[model samples]
Target: MISEKDFIAKSSTVTIDNGSFQWSAPSNIALVKYWGKRENTNSSNAISSEQIPANPSVSFTLNHCKTITKLAFAKKQDQSSFSFDLLFEGQPKEEFKPKIQKFLERIAVYCPYLKEYHFTIATENTFPHSSGIASSASGMAALAMNIMSLEKALYPEMTEDFFYQKASFLARLGSGSACRSVKGSVVVWGNNTSINGSSDLFGVEFPNTIHANFKNYQDTILLVDKGEKVVSSTVGHNLMHNHPFAEQRFEQAHQNLSKLKKVLENGDLQQFIQIVESEALTLHAMMMTSLPYFILMKPNTLEIINKIWKFRNETQTPVCFTLDAGANVHVLYPENVSETVLQFIQAELVGYCQNGNYICDQIGEGAINLSV
Candidate 1:
């Protein structure tokens, strides 16, 4: 079991030189969405600083929709505090600095070397900005990987498993979903009785034999609304604190994950569709029943969903949809049915998309160190 103290950096006499590292990490879509955080308490009933989820959630790590980051660091004479410059898509992005600054502060205890160097971080996304994809997940995971590369340079004997685990651990502090972006065709976050080696501290790859039917699953993201959400995910999660149905909802997530495991193992597409769609609706249902009671799904979002339902019922093509905390819909289907589904999407669903825009992606193998 990994503990919080394991992440703390020990003093080292080894001197490190200035260097640059680049990495790319992909965004992910949660099959069982993580909606709320635990009440900052550990097993011993003591206050804790770690990000712990109320329920375990699993996701498909996406290919193509990702963030690529380049981190260039130089040793500083005055190693008193953390210093960094942020750039987005080749231009200086001041608005993004605060988030990165907070991330650095959160992980500083784990990576003390940050204080000794000045960093220039340039990042860009494959998807459109504010397009409903979780850029924070990919961005933070990529940044964590680059930082891990720096750490590896300091301790060359680090094992691959430890390196990825620690990277996922640090990424979770930046964005909760980012822990899953560090690895995967499928990843699970939060501890559950059914899944071994799972922890709220980081995401673990789904550690069971997956049926071949799920291989190369297609995720066609329909751009229903290409604007920012009125309620950020963080705000939504906070609202769960006093939510009347929070407990029930959290329990439902665990049940759905258990069901999903069998579905994945048996290639039960019908069960998969039912659980995935119900989970998506349940996520929004929690939002609607929250104290503030806000909805993220737009009119076109409903329209697209209805169309998908009609198309599926009429043709039985095994295509279904899942949602993040946004208006966009992710149309998921097995690879074998890709041609027919793409035809249906283009012919029937394209009209509902914002500017007729959609992206084609699939499950991917986590992040890559481009500098390597």
Candidate 2:
């Protein structure tokens, strides 16, 4: 079997050689938010991912921890049969076998040449696995980007966009927003057109340019209630559609999208905070609008929000909070103030709640390939 030593070259930009490939994916933060989908194929695929900053979506794909993959093929029987084996950090993880199997099956249709041999793929996440940060998007992007590099190496005639498009679609199958994560700082998807919810409206259309410019902003996530998985981003999205406030929330989200884009273009931190906070409030509001509805905030979650608000009131800081379907509140504070903000939150959380833990985070660098 081919090994890392003899397989491929590595770099931040995409690369490939022989039948092997390695690449990276950057985690995306939705500025305008991409919630409530027109399609409900899966949880990650339920919504589009948008940008929230005014820095042209500058994400880092650092040289730190990252997922790398290599592909190889072996002849099985007389028919050139195929099977995938995965090694995580050196040891094998069977959990990814199914994900790999299905990924290979889907890719086969696009790259018929893939059926010619068996592929051995390896992957790893830079962050802790199963974290609530929707790590799958970037992880899948890394996987798909690596595979696309393999395809490009195997077929040099292919265009980069062609490879990326294939990867984007495959990434979508794995995680919806991931498709957009394939490129652009501020990517937008789903109800991309101004259809006004009319029947005449065409299907989804993602723009080719950066829709916003998010600056260097770090997200500090509190693990207050990282327990049993809350409703899937998919199920929650569907509930938003069928719920009575579906249309109204959509309208509000559309408006928020416009406002966020404007804030990004203008680079107004106060306006940025205004739009981000409003969108966060709207996301939670839609959740409560669902039947058999519930809220994900814990006592600590409220305390965090309260303290942030109080601190902001006292210091006139631009810190803001956004929640998904969990009790973990993602505090979006500017990078320049990350240290102070993180220290303040951690100290307060430890002092007031005494139970919740705060993990210091940065405007995570985008995806990157690793060597050694």
TM-score of each: 0.97, 0.75
Index of the highest-TM-score prediction:
1
Off by over 4 Å in 1: 43-48
- Candidate 1 local lDDT, 1-372, one digit each (tens): 777777777776678768899999999999999999875555432323656788999999999999999999999989888899998999999999999988888888788899999999999999988676769999999999999999988888788998999999999989999999998789999988888899888899999999998999999999988888899999999899899999999999999999998898899999999999999999999999999999999999999999999999999889999999998999999999999999999999999988999999999989998997
Candidate 2 Cα misplacement greater than 4 A, ranges: 1-18, 39-82, 104-108, 191-214, 350-356, 369-372
Per-prediction tally of clashes: 0, 19
The root-mean-square deviation over C-alpha atoms between each candidate and the true structure, in angstroms, is 1.5, 8.5
- Poorest 10 consecutive residues by lDDT, candidate 2: 50-59
Cand. 2 TM to true fold: 0.75
- How well does candidate 1 score on lDDT at residue 168? 95
